[model samples]
Target chain A: MVDGIVITGAGIVSAIGVGKDETLRSLLARRSGLPGGKVGLSDLQMKTILGIPGEETVARSSLLGILAVKEALQEAGISYTGTAVLVSGTTVGGMDITEEHYLEMLGGEHPELFRFHTCGSSTDRIAAYFGGFGSLTTTSTACSSAANSIIFGANLIRSGRFDVVVAGGSECLTRYHTAGFDSLMILDKEPCRPFDASRAGLNLGEGAGFIVLESSAHASSRGARVLGRLDGWGNACDAFHQTASSPDGEGAFLAMTKALEMAGLRPEDIDYINAHGTGTVNNDESESKAMTRLFGGCVPPVSSTKSFTGHTTSASGGIEAVICLLAMEYGFIPANLGWKEPSEGCIKPESEGRSKVFLQHVLCNSFAFGGNDSSLLISNARDYE
Target chain B: MNRKVYIRAAAQISVQEPLCEDWMLDPKQLSGPFLHCIDPDYRQFFSPMQARRMGLMFKRAMVTSRKVLEASGVECPDAIITGTALGCIENTERFLDPLCRGGEETLSPTAFMQSTHNTVGSMVAIALGCHGYNCTYSQDGVSFESTLLDAVLQLECEGAGNVLAGAHDEITDNVARLMEATEPGGYPFSEGSVAMLLSAGESLPDALCEVSDVRILSRREAVEEAVAGYSAEYVMRNDVTFSLFGRCGSASGLAVYAAAEMIAAGRYSSVLVVNESGSNAGLVFLKKV
Candidate 1:
């Protein structure tokens, strides 16, 4: 088992499901959560569980965050310890709610909504909903926001700053981002095919995913069951384009390389890769190039669950991370759905789901706009021991 | 882990004179409920083509970063980290106003592309072609504090020799009015940017000041308890710059800048910077090098 920082629990809420059990079933069944071409979660049913009054308008990001965080805390058996920190990643923030009332806000009405307009508001709302946290920080690095939050939380624990940190991100679809991505001509109206030759673009989704991380000393003292170990993480800037990745995938290559180096693992050791395949032609091709550059023909079973979950934007990193952990804990490989035919020079992903094989190491990638690319290396317990 | 972090250089574009420390000599008294940065001629640093597509917030972040790098002579920092609450607000409004006023018709992608919170920091990396660790924090008052905390860890523990860290936020008319009407009696809603080049103390031959510890806590935390263990010369409970610099999400950078200015001028050997947003509070410790 990993002898250091370990993941005690993880929680997720997406179109696929509200918790890990539901998500696992959907993944193995190859169910597409993109119900009828749109990526929307039913808020009425989710809100009933939130306990907030129906009249009060809570940001969708915060609502999803609370659901995920509550499940994570419950699984981790963590009580209300004020010293536990919360590092949240959310770029949508309250924009999901505020965008509807934008003009009213401009007119100085619905000013209450203004408080949740910033990117940090959702994190604050979640922390407030769950009593309080010792400290809170929010990362807003586009889609990688939540991924970077987990990295920051890991750094906090490694620095001997805190015993535990709740790290992940939550994002909800908004007309703001939908129209923004649409105007950029990157969104595909049809179902997205991540690595196929005809891969067009991504369908945006909304959800939240959170994981409870604790130091080895703390977990052992509390007799916590370690789900997985956060072996390594790396964040790098492409510096190539504001929104486009380099043709060589230099940033993605560097991020993956750094993570592998940190984890002290060779490329061949990784059992699977959760690709940042947003189905955009540029992204799939570039990420393949990065994988080729790093893995050099021996790339592992890589899959992009975005085809199933519909590119959750900021939440994809955390959601896919929990997905990887689930695959490792169980013995299943999530199929890279929507792949028809792979283009030349592009590595062919595992087209079908496989189970009953023990996974040792897994890598998940989340690349964001502005070329903020990040990669995480997760390892199953008992391997190192 | 105990390696001391040092501030090599500090630069700001605020209500005070841009590209200079005129605020220390003759501090500008904010005269309105909203204040804007007295921008310098960006043409000196940015070509017209480079300046054309960027919004004001992007320009301010770039100019301040250029200043920080120029002062420290560090062409490419090991990491570029920043904090911004309302990222690219001007662009956000530019993209939103037309669409919200009408329908989803004729929405431009330029503003939308530059509207992400990480745009400011990532643009710096693109300009310098420095592909290193890059991040953006978007909390409220503690945005800058969060960046500083990351920078400290980078320098001390992560083997990053140097880092460019800062914060930038701009208040638009609608947002300013919203803040004014909602949170009355608060500092004048303002716009500003501050960048600091930081390195470990032992690695740098000379530093402007030293940053030792940064602690973030809930807003419910008492100032005394937050600073109970640390001994500092200037223990700022609430940051001392809002009245002068006005209130911005990244205003805490102004506090750190002000603290560094004081340390440089031999006014204080050590200083504490505290910033409390609505939800959480951040405390930073700075000492004279």
Candidate 2:
């Protein structure tokens, strides 16, 4: 098997916190960031909302992404030199800005505001901040975007292409997204409860999460402190529906199964699962079924962190991946906040709550609209011997 | 061990015309500053209800994917992978327009649901009932090349037999205006779709070509290193006669175009094609053997 890609450093900016340490602290404290909505979009306006704090200065999405990337770079202890590939995933890039400014443009004034309409401009601006010029790309696959970005970055490293890559995803709350979810009738009126029988819908949140990925050789050359190694990843499509997952969670199951198979591990080897858990009725049910089918009665401790941070769309996977890596490092399982009781469909594990077990392997899932499903397996590099 | 994948059937729908036997050989010149696909009659493939909800890009993707499936004689590919630079821009524009106009009220879900970049791939899957490995990559010009790389990987690493891989981009009125306004030096606004049926173990009577290698890069040195790493014949190959480059999007398509030109000109029996997007490049080496 190929030597796994090393995640030397990571950064995060979420409603709960601005950096990795703060995010971890919030998780341990069970501090949910799903309070009064911001960006002029109130909970009354948006059926379900998870607004980011301190939204006055930076563009919510760009701010979160920039801060996260900066922290990641600092954690990696590598100065930005030479060409750096920037692969970002986001479902709503600058939509928050465009949605607001577009009105000004249509009002017969301030036509200059129209420039933000191009989703790529967000990446360009972010790249400009870092003085990066080698290559920059963006992926917009709804919810699974960041996971795909991570997968793409891993492939590039495995293929011996780039020396380093900043791969992650960022998204900010927007009136457009709020309206879209409201229209779909999937926006919860209160904090989202994943896999809860009375779960109404998902509460939309915004944040950015980034990981500095480098080849094993590059990481060792720099003496970087490797948090975890991205051992295996798999992406599969259900081809079932546009907005809803298959009833049997075929895509989710395949994605998880493929990820485990790629790592040459059985389902029992997984210690914890970071579920996509948008808190939507369909998603929770489908993901539960998929877990049941894959792990059977001996399912590992699975939790949906969306209750704490809300569903961040494309950024969900990236942010949650960071949480998983952190949990592995700390040897703790983050609680599934707002999970009062498991839904009827849920397959509970033997462990009642977060275990103090030494974490070896972790699985993260991100399933998006259009039946896009992705799973990533991360493990401590030293475990492979 | 990595296994070589072959592109058995290729289809394209662009500003020129739909994928016809003659269209690939003959050329069509577009007159307008902005380019739009000479859209095939989508009604022929989809019903009014389904067709009504689909934007121009979705229609083009469905039409092209169908044409490719027919050409390959494979009803459902084992995997479907797609790439789009700016996916479903029309729907996105539509959804954004009213929200921006009416203060987030009266926004339509149809356009919003269809606005995501993977809509085309999802629609293809829904149409074919192919619940296989489906993915959509959106990294600007390299989108298609990335999709091709993943399809090849599915064959090499995932043991996928038949895969449908392609790239598409569509031009919307707002997007076209934005392109002209922001990056005028860039290629004119264009819309098109291209799909290829890929497989391992050649079975066709005269297989077009077998993909030998693929790569993605961010820097010029990296690109050069990748090219050199392959120790591939940079200039003349014994069998490469021509190469085809999709040069509209950055020089990303140049590598592939050059290889195809060499093969097509009878200078070589095989060819290689490369496509790149904003910061990523993809190389597909096709050998006659």
Candidate 3:
């Protein structure tokens, strides 16, 4: 088998918490970040709490990315490696800043604000803060953006392209995105209930999540501690609908099956699954069908951390990857908060968090609009020779 | 054990004349502040209903992708990857303009639905009915190059036979005015869609060129060095310096197309193409065998 792409560092910020510990604590305590009122955008006023604090005038996306990168580099105890590539993912990018100054920008009052309108600006700012990266790029495939970034980073390493890659995604809440979602009628009136019979839709949230991936050879050479292993990743497009998933979950099933095939693992080998349960009527149903089809009658225990942090969109993949790391480290499976009854084909999510089980391999799924579906396999590094 | 990737076919729809076989030989330079793409007949490509719902960028992407696939004789590709700096900006602005003016009450859900970056790629997939590996990238200047890198890896490392990788960016009136004001002397505000069918097979009927390698730079200092290294390695003896440096940053795929054109015309055996936006940069090495 091919050597695993070892994860050496991780960082995250979300509505649930700012760092790994706080996020994990919130997950274990079954706390929801939904604060009963309108957050950023108007008209969808059901008390969805926007997690970012009002600390700086800079774009919230850049701030989140910088914060996450800082923690990841600090944890890894490395800085400014020459051959490093930073493949960041973001959906809204600097839309937060642009939306705040849209009127001014439109009136030609502030041309400076115009530069921050592009998605690459946030990624560039993040790279600048870290001195610089030799290679940097951004992926924006809706919700699966960050997961695809991780896959890109891993491929860079596995293809003998680059040894060190900082991969993840960041997104900040914006009135533009919120209103768009509102226009689509996908925001929940009550706090989101993933896999629940009464589930309405996802509660939009903002945050950033990232992990530092290094080759095992490079990590050991630098004496850096290995956090986990990125065993496999796969991405597929549904080609079914622009916004809705196919009834059969063809894209989702292909993504999972490809990831497993790449990892050289069987369906029974997966210990747990972090499902891409967006708490939407379409997503929950489609993903549930996909999970059932992939694992057959013996589906692994599953949960959606979105129940705690809300759907972070592009950053959800990165944040959930960090959550998976915390789960493995703490020897626990996170609870799928707000889930009461089982939806169609989905096995009942673990609403009660479980701990002290010997966990090994875990699968993380992220499906996005436009049929962009991706799945990642993360395994405990200690299990590898 | 390095696998070679070849560009089986390349197609582009840009500000220049649409689908002219000899466009580059006598290219039309953009003299105005804005350069809108010369669109092909939409009626021939999309249904009336599809055209009614489609935005400018989405239509351009579909036409470009269809032309490229037809040119390559590829009915279905293994993967479809795309990148766009400002995806469906016209639709986004349409939705945002009304929402910002009349609040959420006047919001158009159709415009909002097509605003995401992945919409163009998905629309193409819907037309092709390709349920294969699909992704979209939207990082300013390097967006297209990022998608190209992913497609290259898919073909070289994974067992992908053919991958359709493309880029599309449209400049709305507001965005074009903003860019014109910000960088008065830079390349004209422009819009375009470029697609290349990349294959790992040993040969093709009319391979434009072999993609030797591609590198993207985020650091200002590293850009020169990386470009120099690749140029020295691949295009040392080549004479032509095909460049669009200060041109439209968002339409970085133009440089890739230019390089492929130079190689395909037998003007140069190898060409190094460079594109930049702010501090980010993308470099491609193309060689004809």
Q: Where in model 1 is the C-alpha error above 4 Å?
A: A1-3, A35-41, B203-205, B237-239
What is the TM-score of model 1 when looking only at chain B? 0.95
Candidate 2's C-alpha runs over 4 A off are A36-60, A81-84, A103-116, A133-136, A348-355, A381-385, B24-26, B47-53, B103-105, B185-188, B200-205, B210-289
Reference-based lDDT, each prediction: 0.86, 0.72, 0.80
Preferred candidate (TM-score higher): 2 or 3:
3
Angstrom error of the Cα, residue B267, model 2: value is: 7.1
Worst window of 10 by summed lDDT in candidate 2 chain B: B237-246
* Candidate 3 residue lDDT tens string, A169-275: 98888888888888899999688888898898888888889999988888988899999999888888888998999988999999999999998999999998999
* TM-score for chain A in each prediction: 0.97, 0.91, 0.93
Best by DockQ: 3
Alpha-carbon RMSD to native, per candidate: 1.8, 5.6, 4.0
What's the TM for model 2?
0.86
- Across residues B1-289, which tens digit of lDDT does each residue of candidate 1 receive? 3467899889899988887876678887777779888999988877899888777877888888988898888999999999897888888888888878776777889889888888899998998899999999998888888899888777755679889998999988888887776577766789999999998856454788988788888746565677767778887655367876888887888889888878988899999887765678888899888
lDDT, candidate 3, at B52: 85
| Candidate 3 runs further than 4 Å off | A35-57, B231-246
lDDT of 1 at B265: 82
